[model samples]
Target chain A: MSALKRVQQWATFARVWHIYDASWQNPFKSAELLKKYLMGLHKPIYHPMNDCGDHVIVINSGDIALPGDEWKRRVYFHHTGYPGGATWTLAWELHSKDPTMVLRKAVYNSMDGNLQRRYTMERLHLFPDANVPTNLLKNVSNQIQQLKAKPKRLDHYSENQVKQFPKIFDYPKDYILK
Target chain B: MLLNMNMIVPLGILRNVLFQSKFPIRSMRIFPRLQLKEIREVQNEKELVIYGEIVPSERANILLKNTHPQACPLCASGLDVKHTDILIISQFVRSDGCMLPRRITGLCRTQQKRMSSLVTMAQKAGLMPNLNPANSKKDPKKRFQWKKFNKYFDESTIKS
Candidate 1:
């Protein structure tokens, strides 16, 4: 087959893929973004039954942010199929046990519970860290923008930049502003 | 006389007569008659040894072609083997979070293929970590240090 023909054939059958960075971003917002791609809502040929969803590769899931005290307040419940077997796990506890669970659960909960949901969920690949295999990385053509800007860490700023900021007033030598 | 009697009597009757003549009736009743082959000892022990080795080699050729039967651990434990089982069994994830090979997992070809796909699905679902630890720029062991901010200065300056 000709190169152009092969390329055209691949384009017709292939689904578009996107990479999402979940670091320092709200988990709920990331989940919503992931759901859009997983459902192929961005595509023109989306159908309810057809498995036409684009693949979403999520990286840095371990670093996903939760607003306020949701980490301690959120509770995940499970039962062991025995009497009095119900158990509850705090969000932080679950995140600590499985770094990816927080993001996975958020995305899973956001999706409609239907047969296609499972298939769509399957396409939403999540990595707890930034590392991704080369094969999957190749599929990612673009990165989805984070809803909130990542807060810059103090250590990330150079000494020059820190010193360059305009000073408003000098503090008294003896006064410690605790 | 015996040859003439053998010709006249039937084979079954001849054997009964021979057995009756050899042992007393009471002894015959107590012990069943033994076949000649059963009572006889082997004349050559070396011949038996040679036959034993030769027979096994012919049987081994047929048996060697079959794979050793090994049940999948999940299946043996009555657990429905899923992608999660693959991660648990392998223990260590690849730098890219790819699955360990079948040789390492001891899974059959079909199970290995199924597991590979499941791992991919798990990765997409945010259920598995995919980052290569070695390639990450951030120090994994860095501790979060607490810094006391001056209340006199605007809080926004320090927060950013």
Candidate 2:
């Protein structure tokens, strides 16, 4: 066999596994990363027909981020095919109903609709929390870097720091602000 | 009841008598019946009588099989991971800045993949913060400022 053919054979057979942390990152950003891995776009052996993609295990899907007022303005719609069957759900409502829905939708939309896409999607696994099965964790070869760093919460601040912070304005003594 | 003789008189005899009295010179002429009889005989031999009424057959009504409704979160949302869809990003990430799993989020495999990637893109674009404000070491007052970049001019083209 030719050397090139032998290398191609290896590329077709070998598969890698990846673990991605979605905590505090925007869902759209996460999807761009997943699209690359799922479609095998990052690999030299990547081809449209070849299933050279690696397995992607996503953890902390519940902690994805949103930039602006999408929680109030964005809406999701559903229809039951009957009279008055249309249902319009706000993004917040959908997320509350199912925390993984937003992430799932984001990823699904990024992929092209085809048999290969479906097969690649089968390799994706999602977890809301960090409790992953040992068998799957054993297969994880690497961890995909998160696009953004998580912001600290107010409760995480030290008591001394909070007290040391300067006041923006002072209220007059005995003044009724209300 | 009295019977009228005129009404009871036979029409054939009355016609013969009237014809004989009116003009004995004219011989009685008979219409031809051989053509009529031949046609009737041929029709009787060829015609077939159908006795029963024809009823059309009906097609069977087969009941359709029921399918399970797709309850996957990704399939239900019908939204893609775009920079503008901030609502999805916020919901997917938790208060502690961790992603929710399929068990809680109820997304299919494909959707989970897409969601994570979109989140990463949003973070890289600086549309979303990497860390939660409350948990970060940076001062909250300086945290939300947008980044600005200055345009550079070519040194070769511009005179100092």
lDDT by residue (A72-129, candidate 2, tens digit) is 4667789999999999987666766776788777887788888787787788888877
Clashes of 2: 61
DockQ, all candidates in order: 0.00, 0.00
**Once superposed on the true structure, which residue ranges of model 1 sit more than 4 Å away at CA?**
A1-13, A172-178, B1-160
Candidate 1 docking category?
A: incorrect
Cα lDDT of candidate 2 equals 0.58
TM-score, structure 1 vs. true:
0.50
| Residue B39 miss distance in model 1 (angstroms) | 99
lDDT by residue for model 1 (A36-133), tens: 88898776667786667889999988777664346667899999999999999988778778889988889999998988877788898889888999
* DockQ class, candidate 2: incorrect
List model 1's recovered fraction of native interface contacts, to 2 decimals.
Answer: 0.00
Q: Which candidate number would show the highest TM-score if scored against the true structure?
A: 1
